[model samples]
Target: MPEYGPLHGETVIFTGTLKSLEVFDLVRQYGGVPVSIPLIQVNEVEEPTDEKRMKTCSDFDWLIFTSQNAVKAFQSKMERFAISVNEIPCKIAAVGTRTAAALEKIGFTVEFIPTVFSADVFVKQFKPTDGELNVLFLKGSLAGSIIREELPFQVVEWTVYETGAKRDSINSLVDLLKSRRDCSVLFASPSAVRVFSEDAVPSVGWSGYTIGAIGHVTERALLEAGATVDVKPEIYTLKELVETLSNRKDEFR
Candidate 1:
């Protein structure tokens, strides 16, 4: 048996609105079972804010998409505005493979991508020649200020989508927590942390199970909610999270 065999036999649950196929594979590779039960449902808020929509591809020199949801929302609004695929004038940038893939599916090739998928690295690699270089950031409403704070040029912020906690998901997660013998829960974003706390934290006491957070923001949310954060990777990306967890398997044991 493996030294971390006990850790592998444990169950890990992932909850959020985002997809978890990649995280699931990583969990399986490390001899852990992964369960996904979304705590929220993601949906576009309304028609893109008119000012923000007009400023996105037309006025900006570079358009930055941090998530696939942002890319999809932007594309949907582009269709509504009657903007042809080739009519986009700004250079396209994506923070992750998923966001890049979303742009690629819409016939836009990514002009720049950072080695690390976090906002810090994304802002680090961003270079603009002119002070007038406008940057349009397509992201969620709850995102932190990385591009806005770091960039020297003008930034147009747009909130394309918002996530809300779902009653069914909350009920399901509560039931799972009550029945499970030994399990770990992974939180990928602050919103997920908020949703978990709002729904399951009161009912599902956090005495026995382990809690893993993806980044500083999620870790802070977990801590503030009175949950013990057992695992937090240095790098914010999913790949780094898995690598960190796999390497630190002994700690869980």
Candidate 2:
């Protein structure tokens, strides 16, 4: 057998979508088993009915995306409507580095990013259009109201996706975790933490497990849920969280 890593015999419950297999591979590389039980699911709407028309058809001046899901949803919607990239008339702004990179991956250039990667900072840095301020916001159903409340401009929202509880194989997952000596959960978003905590029954030995939240928002949710968070990554990404857990093996142990 090969040598075991510091995380040998450990297990990690991943609560995010499998957008990529990076999280699973990282956990295994660190000698921890990865158990995926995504607490939230995002489904892109096949069409934008409320927004009614393509953003290029409106007098939209700016397009904003907060998460990679929002960016991917926008791209998927645009493609559905046959709206080509060259046809987009407005500039794009993204909240986080990953969001910006996602936009670039779809051949859309990001024009603005705040100094910090939070909705508050992005809202404060947002510049409004001169007249009517027709800005387009690509949003998820469960998205926070900060963008709507803080916008100085008139916002046209295209809710391209809906995010909700995604629970399956919960009993089996609980059994799997119960067998592990050092089990930790990884939470990428606040909603993920909320859904998992609220749905988890009291019979489950939640107290025995450790939690890892990706950012302050998720950390707040974990705190509110009364879950003992073992690790929280400063960078607020899945890869960073896995790497941080690998480095600080004692924390989870």
Candidate 3:
């Protein structure tokens, strides 16, 4: 028989959209049975002003992306406007490793990534040159004001995408929680935590499951929602979250 990993037959439930199979594979590699209960959907914002901004993207000194969704939306807009990668002359900043990898995959060079994956750390650690810099933050509608409010540089935020709860997944998730209390549930964003809290918690309650959050922000959301965060990765990535959860399998067991 093949050797099972630490998770060994544990059900790992993801409460957000699958960005890629990386997290799922990681969970499976650790002997966890990964399950997807997508509770959020992200869609690019299509507006005339957005196109205008993309057209003059080179006007900014820096382009900042705080999430992979922003990178995806930015890439879609770039293709829509026939804007080539070489046409964008501004330096790029990504908040996390996955976000940086996404930007790099699109042939764009990422000039800055903070020591940590959070915006609060990003503002503190990201040291740009001493000058008047016009920075454009490409973000989602649900993004917080940290980048805009904290950064010392002249920052203009463009909402490139919007996040909404996937109402259809509520029933499915509630059903899973109702049936299986041993599952380790992972939340990637505050949006997903909110959806699970508002829609699923009232029905099934989240006490029995092993709650996992990807980052501090999401962990705060879970705490605010009155759910105890059982597993949280210090690195704030889905793969890390899974590995962290797997490492704590004994605690949950």
Candidate 4:
């Protein structure tokens, strides 16, 4: 399977909030050198109230989860407010496989997962609500505006979690990852890319390195931060990222 699963012996650096142990295992399974340094710290937002949740649970036409962090933060807020998943009286939609899995684990059957993992594609693919579709987004602090801008549905956003750079972890990660022209640093979000680009610039420049982004948003973030992205999957899912790396003939080039 070397021709197909060719990530063996490759050093991959990961930086994100979820502590992607599953991704690490997947990398190892594909024979990659899995190095994960979580640089984005996730903190729950304390502002959501029972009144707001009560309105949200019963009012929205569709409740959309964009990330696993969103699902997790929503669960924590719901539990604190004594809200139940079954009480969310709307159709549920998740963006990625992991996001769908997280919701499923918490007893919510995901009603829709778009054919392509892009928010733009999801906006086009998902069947709208009967009348006006009001989407409640469980999102992080520095999330991109693709969903709000691109979707035809009315979006109500709740910042369920805050994402910030874990500089101590990033500094230490930079020490280990410097001068890795042959290595690929995989970024999953704009925040992670923001952190890495700011912190890792002192020791190494990304001009000669191979950078892998999870999606267009992340790719734009990396480019805006002056990092050259070399690889991204056909689909934006984490599993597909590894597969894309495995399948690419010259991933490190």
Candidate 5:
């Protein structure tokens, strides 16, 4: 008989807005079942100002992206405006490896990524050349104002996407919690945590299932909602989160 790992026979649930095949395969590789029930929905915002702002991409000294959604939305806007990636003269900075990978996929070389995948760390660590620099931050509607408020340089923000709770997934999530006690729920974003707490927690409560959070931000959200976090990776990526969960599977049992 083949020896089974700690994650053997575990049912892992993903509650992020976006589903990744890579993340799913990681769970399966560790002998766990991966379920996708998104708790949030992210959509690009369409406005007349999109083209105007995108046209000014070259005017900025640096372009910043904190989320993969921002990168995806930026690419979409660029395509819509018939603007090639080579046309943008500004160097790009991403907060996390996944965000940087997304930018790199679109042919933008990532110039900076913080040691820690957070805005506060990025602002504290990022050192620019001695000059008046203009940074344009492409972000979602729900993104925090840390970059704009904390950075000393002139920072302009462009809202690329809007995130909202996926109310349709509420019932499914509640049912999962009610029926399964041995499952592990993975939360990638605070928005997903908020939705899970607001819509599903009241029905099934926030206990019994193993909880995994991707980063400190999501872990903080889970804590604020009175949920216990059992798994959190040192690195804030989905792959790392799954690996951490797999390594700590014995603890949950």
Candidate 6:
């Protein structure tokens, strides 16, 4: 087990997509107890509309994927269209390592990736060519436009997946937080923070536990919901978050 200090003996709760368990195991190795309470469920929306599919593939100079869910959903749509990932002509960009890994798994090489895996950094790096650099953004329906709003290119947004709060799971998280005196909560997205805060804010008093946010947006959401943020990783990835917490375990102790 890898050693981490500041997180030693802390109980951490995860509330988002558990695409990979590497982060969870790292937390435990660093002496932090990891708890997974999924607050948002991802559902794929697949309907064969030629107009939308054609526009996604043909009209875009750059295809941007923000999440792994988007990659999977887009891949599924591409299969329906009889389009292969290797055959695509446009440049591919992924917001984070996870999404980039998904693209790599599907045989598509990512041409652009930001240092920090956020829309702000991505927009800073995005240089649109003249004469309508059509960009196809594959992301969740509820995702905010930190990238879309700032891009100089002609952006076409597509909701490849929908995110909704898991209401039943909220009670369990509240109960766990209430019972445990020393525990931390992890928020991966602004939506998860919003959903969890809507009910969890009133149910569990915020003073006893630590809150870990993945990025600036998530931290802002957590703060807006009246919860104090204890940890936020500089890099916007789960692996980095776990590692940073592991390395700085003594701070929380």
lDDT of each: 0.76, 0.77, 0.88, 0.77, 0.88, 0.81
Clashes found in each candidate (C-alpha, N, C closer than 3 A): 1, 0, 0, 1, 0, 6
Off by over 4 Å in 3: 1-3, 250-253
Alpha-carbon runs more than 4 Å astray in model 2: 47-52, 55-58, 127-133, 250-253
Q: CA shift at 175, candidate 5, in angstroms?
A: 1.2
Cα TM-score per model: 0.81, 0.88, 0.96, 0.87, 0.96, 0.90
Report the candidate with higher TM-score, 5 versus 6. 5
Tens-digit lDDT track of model 2 for 1-253: 1148866877888887867787888888888888888878898866536344664534677888888898887777777767787788678889888889999998888999876677877899877445666778888888888888888887767677889887774566667666767877788888877777766634464587767888777787778777777788777678888988887884545
Query: What would the per-residue lDDT of candidate 5 be over residues 1-253, giving only the tens digit for each residue?
Result: 1147677877899998553599888777777888899988999999988898888899999999999999989999999999998889798899999999999998999999999898878999888885889999999999999999999999999899999988898888788778775689999999999998888888877778889999998899899989999989998898999999988885656
Candidate 4 scores a C-alpha RMSD against the true structure in Å of 3.0
Of models 2 and 3, which has the larger TM-score? Answer: 3
Poorest 10 consecutive residues of model 1 by lDDT? Answer: 1-10
Ranking by lDDT: 5, 3, 6, 2, 4, 1
Q: List, residue by residue over 12-114, the lDDT tens digit for candidate 3.
A: 9998878899888887787778899899999999997866788788999999999999999999999988889999989999999999999999999999998
Model 4 is weakest, by summed lDDT over 10 consecutive residues, at: 1-10
User: Worst ten-residue run, lDDT, model 5?
Assistant: 1-10
- Off-target runs (Cα >4 Å) in candidate 5 are 1-3, 251-253
Candidates sorted by TM-score, descending order?
Answer: 5, 3, 6, 2, 4, 1
Q: Which scores higher on lDDT, 4 or 6?
A: 6
After the best TM-score superposition of candidate 2, give how far the Cα of residue 28 lies from its true spot, in angstroms. Answer: 2.4
The lDDT of model 4 is: 0.77
- Please tell me which model should have the higher lDDT, number 1 or number 2: 2
Model 5 has an lDDT value of: 0.88
Q: Which tens-of-lDDT digit does each residue in 1-253 have in candidate 6?
A: 4464566667888899799888888787777788889999998886667436754585578899888989888877777777876567788999998899999998898988888888878899877554678888888989888767888877878888998988788899999888877787888998888888787878776778777889997888888888888778998888777766655556535
Worst 10 residues of 6 by lDDT: 47-56
